[model samples]
Target: MARLIATAEDFAFGPAGKLVTVAEELAARGHALTFAGSGTALQLAERADCWDEVVACPTDAPEFEELVGSRMAAADLLVSCVDRPSVELARKHGLPVAWLDPLTWWWGDEAPVWLPDLELCVVQRSIGAGDAAGPYQELPANHVVVGPIVRTGPERRGDAGSGPLLVNFGGGEAADWYQPGRDTNYPYVIIDLLLTQIDLTGFSQVVVASGERIAAEARRRWPDAPVSFECLGHRDFVERLSSAQAFLTVPGLEAPLEGWAAGVPTLFLPPSNSSQYVQLDEFRRRGVGDLSVHLRDFLPPLDLLSAPLRDRSERFIEQLRDFERTPTIRTEVAARLSDLLTHPEGWMPAVRRGHAYLDELGRDGLERCVAAICALVEREGESA
Candidate 1:
């Protein structure tokens, strides 16, 4: 058995979830694994039990580099979720690294000197075509375009019935900027807006599967609403998503991909990051999902706040304020949601297109990824 270290920036569940899936598969195949990340990544690594040790390697921590270096020194190989520091550190230790990039957004921009030995990109062919005519085209030593690394849930029972509208906006602590501090908090602004403009008589149930704090805040805001707030574990979250009839979320890769895998239509909110914006744009271009509504359309502009919001980019803040101030924004958003829920058939074209792409990509990406990692390990043994 070979010892491997897997690392990612402690951003959200997407990176950590992918690493957990790979680590679990490798562990089941008789490999020793350690997971090093921050925030939700560390939390998930511990809960999943896919790693021998779960290390808190936050980027801002003073001894982050020392901790990562110490772990890499003991491992025969490294598999990372496309972090430059981890990749460089693994190379410094002369360990082969497999970089798993689920978004495929890491073009050859400002890359580190020591690239990964294998670059496994989890995206559709059109996204990972590598057709950029320049040095960027041939960036990695071994570039492989794999399917989306989605977490599978139990076979959904036929009697699950029409599930609630599953809502999630990635993981990690919610930013305070989005919080209005009224009765509603950040991230649930849309829910509050919908509540004001629409009767919600047509919909039976709404579920928000974010963290406990968000769920608690949601309940505090709308105590009488039919919405149920839950902070589920990874497996349960996927199960809920699979049985859900529709989705309302930030346009991140994992949640949208899960929604597509389940063949449900999603109504997206404006993205919180540049990578998400790009990916969501691609989804719109490909007719995989509907275009997201601007944040201003759902709530009052951020500039109206007396003080600057923390933990948000100035550019995003500016964009949020850039929308034309209009009194009918809530009515417009309500109309859009009404159309989406009442006439679900209008969304079938996009839903079918997304499912078809997922079908062609196949669901055995984790198996293929495991095989590739094992091959790399065997090759190192042969060389030794």
Candidate 2:
């Protein structure tokens, strides 16, 4: 069995939850796995039975480096979600590491630079980082393009609201990060504008998932709005996505990926003239969902393709949104992911052969890309 140490050390939402899910799956396969980190990660590690050892670092322990070094030496494989002290420690010990790809508009210079250094970089195929970075194409060839490994088994049952618009914009250890940016002309900004333009009386509920300050502000502004707010675990969040009608947000890689998985139709707001727009284009090509330039642009396209959902309640709307993100490719990604785990030498051939649609898209075009995603998802279900 491949002994693994899951590094749940990121502050962001991308990888921490995914790492826990991967650890559980790996443990079910009988691999020895441990979790090491501080802050909220300590709490998560405590609840997980998959972990062989939970190394808790003090809030500000000076000997943290030495402690992490010792832990890294103990494990043969260090599968990480976050990249910080954990990435550096993995490097010092020469352990294979898996880092999540985060490429949104807000990312700084460091995002692309650090990802390449890891022994294996597991990225969302949607991020397009595989094509952008020379390291993915040139260097040690450790990049593994796995769809974000999410919890898909079951969800807590909740009666979803039909007319109510559930806006979930925050979930993580700290809720303060998803602050509404007034200046950025992103989807969040566009969402705010559309909410105001529409008749408030038409919608039954306006649920907002966010920090206390933003939630409070939303409630105050729309006092008559039937708004409910609560913190949700990962499973609950996925269940909510499964039940929602339509999603409005910046065309982020993660949200769209989740929306696609649930088959929920979405309206993506991309920065003008960005390559990021390509992600949404692929979603549209698959008949997965729609996109808009702004609120006004949305009305016409939505009126044309989404008559069934046009005047529906939030519950009905959410149902309409569930349009099958990319079919279901969990198995193919997992198979490829497992191949990398079991046979290290096989990485280059699979990547070079453009395993699945990645290669087809490279040779063919957008149509091939869509076919690849569909094939990947169906094949995963078959294998499972």
Candidate 3:
């Protein structure tokens, strides 16, 4: 029974998705585990409620190293999802570590130095192909490239029934662009536009999941619109998703990947952050969604994305502001929603295409990661 510490970058829910899945599998295998995160990742981590201790390790905390270093000294192994600092700390303590990366195409020069023997790199593809958005570094013998890493993974739904429409306005914060006050800023940009143009009364039992601020706004706007607004934990969100007739959300990698894994029909709302914009582009390039609507059409200069991370992120924010301010874009979003609501089953054909894309890449990432981590842990223990 090795002691394990797992963590994910707090930028979005996607990294936490990978963290919790790996931690859950390791815990079920009789290993003691701790989960560390902040922001959306922390929120999702607490929802799992399976950890021996869940420490809130904010990256900017003055005692961040001390907080993480203490855990490293105690743990037998470190498992990280797109979090480099934790891996570095574990290596500093001379421990075995496994790194999970879902955005291999985006990190470029920011990735950590590979430890040939003691670390295992599980690099996952963002989409089918054409993800060479930035420079990619090759890995050593300890690395394996795989597809999406999802939880409670069961491919092919058993007849998606007339379940409620799952409308997700996922985590609202990213680096400098998003903060506490920014909750109702976007996706809501489209939602506000949506409510004005289409009456959701046509759809029954609409469940909109997001932070409290967003939920409150939805409730206030459509007091009698027959919608149930909620702030679901990671596990509860998945429970809701499993039965969803169709899904519409920000184009972050995790949620759609979760839907795709379940064979749930999905449509992407516009992205809120740079990573999501890139993800949206890849989803469109692959033609894998409920009639893919590429945001790039509105924001020309796809070359802006190839710029440095900070520059590109700023560019996305500017363009999103323009998108919100534009009358045509508001109408475009509303029209898309109205058309989809008219034909509810229209998302499935594109979802089948999504499944075919996954089938092309293979979805054994979770199993492969678990096997590698287990092997790494056991080998390290034997060596000690």
Candidate 4:
């Protein structure tokens, strides 16, 4: 059995989930798997029950490079999800490295300085193709767009007509990144504002899945609003998404891809950052989801007593005000929500298009990825 070191960015749910899926598949194939990444990655690895060992190594840690370099020296191959440290370490050790980048957001001049030996892109085309230059322009030659890396889970019954409306703003990582030092209640605030405008008479239930902090806040805010506030694991999260009737979430790559796979149309809220804004725009352009609606357009300014939180809120409002300077594109966010809720069937065309795209691209992404890893490992063994 080959010894494989898998690493990924662990701050968010998507990368951790994808890494766990890869680790599980490789472990099941009898390969020895060791995972090195952030605390989120460790948590996901523990949940997946695959890794022989897990090391919590945040990307920005001072010793992260040295730690990953040591691991790379012992591993037969490296599989990574946006873990640049691991890729750099692999390059130093001359080890084969495969990058499974689901977001495909790292391209053009913004691409990582050190390219992986193999790039498994999750999108059909590399982003910013026109701006790519020199050696970076040839980077896509090694890219294999395998679509979104969706993990297999317990078969879920499709309840598109009656399933719960899933509301998620992503995991606690996003909260920590977007509104540090504040109670993670921004998503609940968005939901509260949305409920004021949209009529949810047709939906059977509303479920809000996020971090414990957000869940607790949701429970407190919507004590009697016909909503369930519970944080679910990755498998259960996907199962829920698979059976969901609709999704209301921040514009993230994983949730939308899962929603598309489940045939659930999503209404995207304004992104918390510029990266999310880019991904959201791509989703809208692909007709996979609605364009982002700024939260400020639907809700008034937030009042926070916490100094850090208040400062963040003020900055956010300023950014929103600047973004809304263009009058022609500015509309009431509530209007879009109302339109989505009133005519859920209107999204079916987009859903069909997205599904067709997935089908054409092939849905057996994990298998293909596993096969590629095995092939790389075999080739390495032969070279040895």
Candidate 5:
């Protein structure tokens, strides 16, 4: 059995989705999966028999190289989400690594140099396939295009929201600048906008999910809103989201996927970060969610999202259902990894060349990639 370590470094608002899905897949295939994550992931994983060993790797801790090195020595592969340090340590110990979520390159430029030595780099889309090379380097090789990996189903028990505008900012694991900054430890902007955006006189309640600190601020901010507002966790939150009529939120990738998955119509309050603002634009282009360009765009005496809103919500729901049925990155990565591991010389160069082209031209470039993968598979088929 292959032994693998999947890292949950991106431990904010269901960051472990990728890790959990991949780890579960690998386990079912007779691989032993060990997990390294913050306390949250460990807490969540405790309910399921997902990981062989759940090591607590806090983000605040000092040099974790020794601890990681020790754990990696027993593994053959490592799959990770936004955890470069752990990936680097795994490679140093001669274990193959697959880095997930290439879209997050916004974190650091130094990622590529640390990334290249891995046996494979799995990306979310054909568009994300490329070198982590320097500011002006041509691409390197051995990247594979795989769709995003998501946990198969919701873990937080219960259905979604019943409120007219069911607003949730998710957990405090990660937050954007518009989200009252990560250090503030609350879902302020999300809560503020949801409560203030629309009239609640006829609406049942305006719900917000926040830590105690943020909840206190929300109560202080809107004393006369004439709506019910409170902070809640897993079960209640999921139930709230599932039943919600309209969702008001700041644009974050995961929650929108969840809202869409649950067939909820959501309005995105403009985000503070310019990159995210543009990304939300791209999401609109890709039919991901509904987004507002400006704050006033979603503001006071808020207009209901009309008929177009229902159509888009249903489209997003359909897409999300298809996405759930679609094969995950692990299945694609596993197939690619297994092939590359068995025939490095022949397959590696083809993957490299394919990735270089895809990175430059995006998925529109994938006609060439598909031909290449087909040709490789054909050649292997003939040989077999």
Candidate 6:
């Protein structure tokens, strides 16, 4: 009944993946949705069956404002995830906007100069244990606080025993703020350790996923590991994790949350960015992420949380010394993986505990936000 324009930040798959979940829900509710995204985010949205139109949201494209403004003309509401430019477009076109931010734990408390006034509803997600002890705090006003915005995960199979153990090295498609090389140095080292140090015979099969460049590197680096590296869009990736008996990956909010939502026994590797560092620590602090590892656990010199927010992973990529070469790091990682892989039934209790913990934090943020977006249009149109 309502026309919706949506977009997500191309920083990582996190925002785009979450947008897909919300968009799919809105589409199921019979709303027409148009999504604008660039790079892999656009590719990801294209894979979803929810969008009526999936246009490229390149800020530098020709007549960008005019093109986007034309699209905005037919929309009743703008839905976005952590993307400022789309919000600016909505404001300029006098459209109602609902801004979804899933990173309340990692973002600064102050709203930007161009933000706030543009938002009809700021769906600020606050998910953590009791404390907001991180460097960032929640914004003070016009907020709808709730939990993580994750789907029910893959359609969950009856035969999970046969599912392969999944290892996600996280993704590499970010804005140009990150330097070249795909941020593969740290995760590549982790994969190298898995190939050389950790034994994978416990699971029937292990599928590794990462960026194209990293997948290429994985093949080049370990040609004989009996493992093929691949990259998956959000839908395929979640479907894989949802059915997995055991999942091992980085502690980024979305992936691990999906694993937890699917009740898969998960082991988190080190953090790729600063926010990931805080998220892993928070999960551990909450006692739900004890099994998860951290960068500090392996590389002591890399104190990512202490550094500035915007400066991420470049030095880690540059000075990435012989990480798997470290005997202690190898030993620690091997032990952690082995512990997760062994007597796998024992791991589910922790996984279930994590599920309960997340539920207690709140899971209805996406539903509530979608309802708000629909209300902004459906009710107003009815009154008219």
Candidate whose TM-score is highest: 3
TM-score of each: 0.79, 0.53, 0.89, 0.76, 0.57, 0.86
Residues 1-384, candidate 5, lDDT per residue (tens digit)?
Answer: 656677755444444544554555566656677776664445444434656887776533565665667777766667776666677677677766666653543333435576566555555442222335522233347566543333213422222333455654443443211233433322444344334443444345556654344556667877775555565544345467766655555455355544544455555544333333434554554444333333222223122222243343344333323322334522332333233223323422332332333234343322332233334334433553
lDDT of 6 by residue, 6-103 (tens): 88887656777778888888999999999887865675687788988878757545565766788898788888888777787778788877777777
lDDT of 3 by residue, 126-219 (tens): 6434445422345577777766677635544435445577888776665444653453257566666655785465444678787555677767
lDDT of each: 0.62, 0.44, 0.73, 0.63, 0.47, 0.70
lDDT (Cα, tens digit) per residue for candidate 2, span 1-384? 555766754343344555665566667766787777664455445556787787777323567667767767766666666545677667767765655443321233335466666555554444333445622344335554444444432322223334444455432222122123321222233234445433334334545553334445556665664456544444555566666544443343344455444444344443221223334454445433333332222222222112222222233222222211222222232232223223324323322232233333232222322233334334433553
Worst 10 contiguous positions by lDDT, candidate 6 = 316-325
RMSD of 1: 5.5
TM-score winner between candidates 4 and 5: 4
Candidate 4 deviant stretches above 4 angstroms: 39-43, 63-71, 103-105, 116-137, 140-142, 151-156, 172-177, 180-185, 194-197, 216-225, 291-331, 360-362
Compare candidates 2 and 6 on lDDT and give the better one: 6
Better of 1 and 2 by lDDT: 1
lDDT per residue as tens, model 1, 234-301: 66677777666667777775777777766666677665543454556566656665635645446544
Residue ranges of candidate 1 with Cα displaced over 4 Å: 65-68, 106-108, 116-139, 151-161, 172-186, 198-204, 211-213, 216-225, 291-314, 321-327, 360-364
Worst 10 residues of 4 by lDDT: 121-130
Which wins on TM-score, candidate 3 or candidate 4? 3
| Worst ten in a row by lDDT for model 2 | 319-328
For every candidate structure, what is the RMSD over all alpha carbons to the true structure, in angstroms? 5.5, 15.8, 2.9, 6.5, 16.5, 3.3
lDDT of 4 by residue, 127-231 (tens): 343243522244455666554566544433555476677877666454235442252334654566556756777778888776555677768777887778877
In terms of lDDT, model 5 sits at 0.47
Which is the better candidate, 3 or 5, if ranked by TM-score?
A: 3
